[model samples]
Target: MFPKTHLTIAAGATVLVAATVLMSPSSNVEAKRMSYALDLEQGSVSAPAKGPASADEQNSGEVKTDTASSSAPTSGEKGQTEATVAAAPSEPALDWQAFEIKSGDTLSSLFKAAGFNDGIMLSVIHGEGDADKLQRLYAGETIRFASDDQGKLAAVELQRNRLKSLKVSRTDDGFKGQILTREPEARPMFASGVIDDSLYASARAAGLNDKLTMELTDIFGWDVDFVYDVRKGDRFEVVYQDLYLDGKKLGTGKILSARFINRGDERLALLYTDDAGNSDYFTPDGKSMRKAILRTPIDARVSSPFNLQRRHPVLGVVRPHEGTDYAAAPGTPIKAAGSGRVISAGRKGGYGRAVVLQHGDGITTLYAHMSRIARGMKAGSRVKQGQTIGYVGSSGLATGPHLHYEYRVNGRPVNSRTVKLPDAKPVPSSEMAQFRKVADQRLAQFNVFEGREQQLAMAEEE
Candidate 1:
């Protein structure tokens, strides 16, 4: 009986131990799991297991806790969680294709090469006003295309130049075009040169381009004859505008002011525009730089001077030479001395091909010995100053290719070299003050540039 009781007690104790192990807090194994919900719009992460209190619940001054449970969430909770996830918006991806225009390449061909059809090209071009720019494409330009994920063109951009572009973008209604322009920064620059052999050579040595050099000559051509008056030591100084884009020099703009020293004579010119929007070069004292007629009709050396009694080279007899002869290469262009009406344009007895111009104030000019007259130059046709009238040739009574130019006043021949040219109208008294103000500023700049050049020369010599 004692053995039976001990056995029973041991069994009872073992059962109690097994019950304690299953019911104790430490013995209860809780599996720790986490769930994440991404808020894509806000770019944040939310924990579903221990989410913050709801806004409505908090406003009522009550807190709702998510009680721990081993089962799945309720149907209402599941629906709310799914609604939060579906609120994010999706954006489509864009693909870009770029093409460089080549010689003989058309918009149609470029579009086809990029895997686009003619219909797409036509729709984009015919939709709006900007489509016209696509038709004016030139070689060496670039066009970029942007398309959505569905392969529909979203935008097109044409880079016209460094400072201009044309853009076309698709809208709900259609495509719209816009022209974009960027302003270039202007910087003041100075250039000075001393003539050693020729004006062009000296200008090039002074870092002047052909365009700027020509402008310089034109500005001072009224006061000095470039062919006859330019001496070996003549000097020039100029202040001009240098255009730049993105810190790189593109080209030159305009000559603000300049000075020319020829044969010990100094001449200054300033550019000014009046309230009437007329721009012209003027002297420091407000006098106009342009005259009624240019000094020479053609850029040629004088081969024969005006002589009363000279032995004619062609006829070999003493004859009165009434006009100055300009020696030039055959086919060289001859320009009209001033604006006038063509009185005659045809072949004469001794002057092979001749053109006569009748100007204002009873002044007339004639050009003879030409290879051919300029087309459209006929009797009664109006001609502007500096217009080409004919070409140089050894026609009629001539020894070589030359232009026999004669300037007459009231039917009497006059020496073109020594004749007093009529000056253009000066600045009116009402605008003199304004003109002087602008002129003073430009002249100051010109002086500054000249002084700097002088200092540089002195430094170089030292």
Candidate 2:
């Protein structure tokens, strides 16, 4: 390479290294896995970047102009739908067969039955973090595994955005496996709902989730709250992407549009376009959700501790507390730290009137010292994050009213608030351009979706 070219390469490596250092932990879950090995001493880029197969391939938007086309949003469209383009007319005889799982079928067994030998099955499973990571595939969720023009495994795509739509292919596999990744389409849409009873109830009624409900609150939590802020007749709506692969569903992507009505006031939000045309959720007037830091650390101050034994203030005896306590007042509503459901909503020993939530992954929490439970609160009810289930009252063995909180990993008491949460994220820089491209298209379509809704409402004389 020429000396000028070498300088250009060296400069490029520096920016990537800087990005690794400055990358936000919340922006991408995969950031931790990125380790920059730049040789600053010589100002030389790494061998990986030097090779023909490099991480910059897709990030640079150097997608192959092959027959395998991706569904993208066209600019200026007000509304859009899930547009899928499968193998067109019968030309190459691409045997794209869809398989529904049988009771006795495993990935390995099925691949063998398909005449490809199960050699790729083991690797595929591990790469997917097992079948559960493969869109939580239980007994029934189907995957449309396919091959390309080269007859090599084109991709193993899930039918929905329940989990990520994963694909693996190779440019070359010499000493190392040369892989190329094609991101599935993640399109934006507009969704809205009203809560006559509770957040989770409303979300489920609107075809959403306790998880998505929590996410919406989190996005706007710096302003509106899930507890006292939620009025009896509050309402909400949102625009987020539904990720897909080869027309198959992968899962919901980031939110693009949102509306939360507390009392009678409506708060409308839209995804704004940046200088680079990258889209991020913003208020209708345009304000970024990227805060300097989270409002609270893991949990509220003095909310919880990790001690097993404590000197009982009233009992005057050293006993196992088994949970940390948050100091608050009676009727101080408690909210879920994340999206989850109520497993228990009544009293417990010494803890007084308590509420317990069973978040997924064997994680659970206990909220105590309640003066009274929220109206319509009960076991088996879903709760969005920060949604109020009860108030703080001196009901249990307490000097005053406060919330006793506990976080459990597996079956052990891990501080729920302080749990160093695992991270996943936005598209990598290597994947950013294409990611933004699709996101832009989705944003445009979302406007149209909302417009049609307004038109329909008008037609009904609402």
Candidate 3:
């Protein structure tokens, strides 16, 4: 209803106002630009977005401080060279998480301390999954506690057995745990030592312990009695396998080579296992170290017997004793002189805590003054040849701590000090040929295991 002149003039006024506003720079207007920089890949540090933020007002509050980033150019500055930012490298998840178990720490309490919720720890510890492992929640053992970004615990690993690491990523029904298995690893190593003193002492000086010592003894046990067989200046060299997992050593896997020299007699053995899983030690000449029986039957520490006619500490008697006695430190182990049965294990006059073993062919051996008898050691219990019967002590008419040991032939005491025991049982006349062949094969393996110098010197010593 308005005149044409009024409508036309109103439109012209709106257009002119829009033009002015577009030309003006408003204070609220923002132009955003992105920035980036190079940085070394040190894991454990979180990285932020590298792209530019949009100039939109809605997204302004979403930005965090970008670490490892360079600042952008300022306004009104001429463009300079822009260094292309390297892409941030990726990092794998952590292997273990450290956790300490305080007193009264049950599985439930530990799960809470490790930032876990209800039911997860109990399920895993109690084997709700297919792990089929025994549950362990000891107070001192550490465990590794791990979780995913969503905060679910995946697996649990004992951290040095004091702390637990739980990985909640792979559990059944969505609970995860540590990787369960690994491939087997085998490695070879060599050790050599000269016996300046005792074989065990020298081996220990060369960094061997109970486990390794047992390994060494087992390698040569078939050939050497170890107790009464080693001579001074005896040298031993062995090459064995070291078993490992994740680069950590577990134990000695096997003994490949071993050499022993007793009284200037040379004996070298190698370990050999046939296709049928039969293994033994044998000399290079194809002789089995395993005779029908071991030559020396005692496990005594000393080679010489006690001299009773000298100074007497308690009895004060200058009587020349008829028997040789062994002095073991109060409770040292005492073994049988041979495969025998208990003739008597009870007290006999001054032979306090004594045990008498009777072997076949009218031979009897006696041990006296024991600290205590091995449990269940009675007259009827069958004992193996080298099994411990009692500890050593001063019992009968003795001066100090020692075992009064006597050897008897046909019920009469004899000088065990001078008696030469019988030789090894010859291999069954029928099994002799096969035994020699088996022995030779083992000896060949031993040579391959020990290097050249060891073989030569061992040969000379033998």
Using lDDT as the measure, which candidate wins?
1
As for TM-score, the candidate ahead, 2 or 3, is 3
Q: After superposition, how far is residue 214 of candidate 2 from its true place, in Å?
A: 2.7
Whole-model alpha-carbon lDDT for candidate 1? 0.85
Which runs in model 1 stand beyond 4 Å of their true positions?
Answer: 1-96, 118-133, 146-149, 154-160, 163-181, 327-331, 393-401, 453-462
Give the top-scoring candidate (TM-score).
Answer: 1
Taking the tens digit of each residue's C-alpha lDDT, what string does model 2 give over 149-263? 6765644655443443443322244111222355879776566677877877888887776667777877666556565467778888777777787788867767766778888
Full candidate order by TM-score, most accurate first: 1, 3, 2
* C-alpha local distance difference test of each model: 0.85, 0.61, 0.62
lDDT of 2: 0.61
Model 1 residue 209 distance off true place after TM-score fit, in angstroms: 2.7
> Per-residue lDDT for 1-462 in model 1, tens only?
569989999999888778645543331122234556665434678777754545775567443335553234578987997897675434445577899899999988988877778888887787686776777899999988878878888878888988898888888988878888988898889998899999999999998899999999998887788877899999988888999998998889888888889988998889999999998899999898888787789999999998878898878899988899999999999999999899999998788899999988888999999999999999999999999999999888888999999988999998888888878789999999999899888978877877888899899999
Model 3: residues >4 Å from true position, as ranges? 1-109, 116-122, 128-142, 145-154, 159-185, 188-235, 242-253, 272-323, 336-340, 359-363, 407-442, 445-462
Candidate 1: residue 251 Cα off by (Å) = 1.3
**lDDT, candidate 3, 1-462, per-residue tens:** 999999999998888778645644443332233343323222344445644445653455333335532233344331332322233334324444666666777666666778776677666755544332424555666766666556666567654331223333454575434534444477866666777778889888866666767877765665565766677788777666787776787766666666666666666666655445667655554455553322333445442354546444456667555466665578888777677678889777877888888777687888887877777577866776678888877766556677777877788776765555543343454655766676565455555655565687799999
- State TM-scores per candidate: 0.70, 0.37, 0.55
Order of candidates by lDDT, top first? 1, 3, 2
- Give the range of the ten consecutive residues with the poorest summed lDDT in model 2: 170-179
